[model samples]
Target: MILIRLESKGPIFYYSYRVGMGYKIFKFYKFRSMHTDADQMVEQLKHLNQYANDEAQTIKTKPLTRSIIAYSNHDHILVKDDELFEESEYEQFKALEDKKAFVKINNDPRITRVGKFIRNTSIDELPQLFNILIGDMSLVGNRPLPLYEAEKLTTDKTVGRFLAPAGLTGLWQVTERGKAGMSAESRCDLDIEYALKHNFWMDMKILFKTPLAALQHENV
Candidate 1:
């Protein structure tokens, strides 16, 4: 089984997964992709609820709604009930709007010098082979998500993706790998579709096509 440790760096929360017997832990290795102080900036931005736009020039605020309350942690926003937001002294509110559930800004400055190359080449994911060998992940399955992202997928409509194995590559990464500005809903739809239709043969085909997909310039 995979054991996950959730760690936060500013607004970024990621999972470090390990597999071992009681009390023993093994290190997971991967190329570094962001600056060490990245979390510090996240903490600074939590109070403002602001993030850089795709161009990395303008800062945008995440609109909130009654059903979606946003609270600040040291360096991240935690969603809870409206009461929680009030208790935390957060006052900004807006009606729910149609927007991507997940957003990745292009040309993000938080990315490190080498990060751009590795991300563009999809080389940063090479370390996951260790996870595959250790049974923490599959060669073909739904892409593993960060804790913050996973928490939002709790609804019945989006939970099916979790039924599939956490993989190094998946339907979204292949079909939409090169597409820019994909909405979160569209990505979730692909994941759900794959979860409902995945089979050994399908997995084989996805694995076969993965190399070519990775070669695309928009692999990031």
Candidate 2:
């Protein structure tokens, strides 16, 4: 069994994870990165996320036929409705449509100011070192998923990702780091691949590459 405990250090409060049963559980520590009621907020936000997912699926199925028109009071107009957009325009449109599925919100009101800073610098994950030190996790392995995310991967095709220990950093996060519009399926494939092929040398390679990966804007 895995146990999560809340503890306070000075002005900061964080969670500690323990994995085991009976008298043998080991404790792991981390700094808090979210609102204190984040867990409760998840349920409230579930329908909104599901709605976003459905919207994304709908956008994927529909062909891009919508056109935009711009009006100018001057003698000439820069763009016309029927004119075809450049490749970059199409990419931008797709990205905009897909934004709902991946982006938390325009500014993400749920995230505290401190939360944003810690997340951007990867400091939010610093406490997980205790887990690594205690053997509950590794420096390089499949990232631990929240219960909601884990449930979606229970299918036979995706379950292989769980064969390895959870990590502080992993394959997809490094390889796909600044690339936009990655699907959940793609992430699962990378996790499963890492689980199947992970070894001491590969782990060391990942550990070495992690700092550069973390520097990228899209650490998710």
Candidate 3:
């Protein structure tokens, strides 16, 4: 936290909305690693993100896409269409449409000086344990999806993976760790695999192999 404070001007910890099992929305946090203006930089690097080009990741599906927002209170209000919204709400709706899945970048420019060290050392993720303790996640399961990613994952094939718990270390992270050119498709496939086959014994095996990744979330 002190190191982060030295290099960053915003909150020392940054939490974003993540979707867990049953499509539960909760705050997922890490040590602040990106620049305060990182949100503003998304458009600049949008083209570099794998999901930016993935049509499969963007198509509006049920449940998640039907979610509406009360901007004043920032609460989710479920309603079907945008025709019922105010003009300002419609603009925000378009903004949400523009969002793509979160992608992990290599040597991303948005990372601050301290950010790289924390991320590389997995210090940025220590806060995830708190989420686990709070029952927002579990010991071994799927990586929770960010809001943008979860919104599109409501598709039939991808949605079933949410049946698995969200976790700090899971089959996908350990299995795919350090592998070259890991694609979003492969990771999501692993999540589905775990969802279908996971059990106590498999969870134990996954925990044993997590050390292979040095406890990193595949940091790709």
Candidate 4:
């Protein structure tokens, strides 16, 4: 089974999303995506009466809410209708998505002044190089995704076939990373298809093509 874990030390946190293949768990590193107090905040919120009531409610309005409900419906189907979340946790995710998308707009309102630069230059992905160096990812392969996209794609069965080592760049990144709003999950499947069919010469071509792709300045 694939295993992913997150941990924190002092004011900083570390995350590693790993894949279990050939009976070992390889740690894939990434920049911290949450605040140091994220867990504490979540636990504190859970203890509130208002929070409990909110958790029991259904999502019927808001774009983020609808998207989450749509995501959940798909995840349920993929899991053979098993409930992977409590109503509150799902709704909370809707809020997080909204926050993610809001600041993620062409000029995001939620991003700090520094975040824009980090995101645009792909500096945020630097941490994943550790994953590459360690063999959790290769120089060319599919992108790993957040859980939402993984859930949606599982229904296709093709997703499982793409579970080889992760990559920092792929066909999807070259084609659409900045040109389109291709979700990370969608990119994963496409990258998988490419990796499955790839050879050494083709991999070399992709590596050479990547710098040109990066120069396009489409992030703005």
Q: Name the best candidate (by TM-score).
A: 3
lDDT of 3 at 77: 43
Q: List residue ranges in candidate 1 displaced over 4 A.
A: 1-29, 39-100, 216-220
Model 3 Cα shift for residue 197 (angstroms): 0.8
> Residue-wise lDDT of candidate 3 within 1-220, one digit each (tens)?
8888887799898888999999999999788999888867767876566434344344443433323443354344435553344444544554444344447566678888888777766678889999998999998999898776788777676787899999888998678765656766677789999999999999999999877665453333
Q: Best by lDDT, which number?
A: 3
Looking at candidate 3, the ten consecutive residues that score lowest on lDDT are 62-71
| RMSD of each predicted structure | 10.8, 12.6, 9.8, 11.6
| C-alpha local distance difference test of each model | 0.58, 0.58, 0.74, 0.48
* 10 residues in a row with least lDDT, candidate 4: 1-10
> Which scores greater on lDDT, model 2 or model 4?
2
Quality of model 3 by C-alpha lDDT: 0.74
Off by over 4 Å in 4: 1-27, 31-110, 181-189, 215-220
- Clash pairs, candidate 2, are none
User: Model 2 over residues 1-220: C-alpha lDDT tens digits?
Assistant: 0111232223354664332211123454555655667656765664444214444434322222333323322322223455444454455454434333222332344556566666667777787887888777777877665544554455577678888777888897789855655555566688889978989988888888898887745322
How should the candidates be ordered by lDDT, best one leading? 3, 2, 1, 4
TM-score of candidate 3 relative to the true fold:
0.73
lDDT of 3 at 112: 87
TM-score of 4: 0.52
Measured on C-alpha atoms, candidate 1 has an lDDT of 0.58
What lDDT score goes with residue 2 in model 1? 15
In model 3, which runs have C-alpha deviations exceeding 4 angstroms?
50-102, 215-220
User: Between prediction 3 and prediction 4, which has the larger TM-score?
Assistant: 3
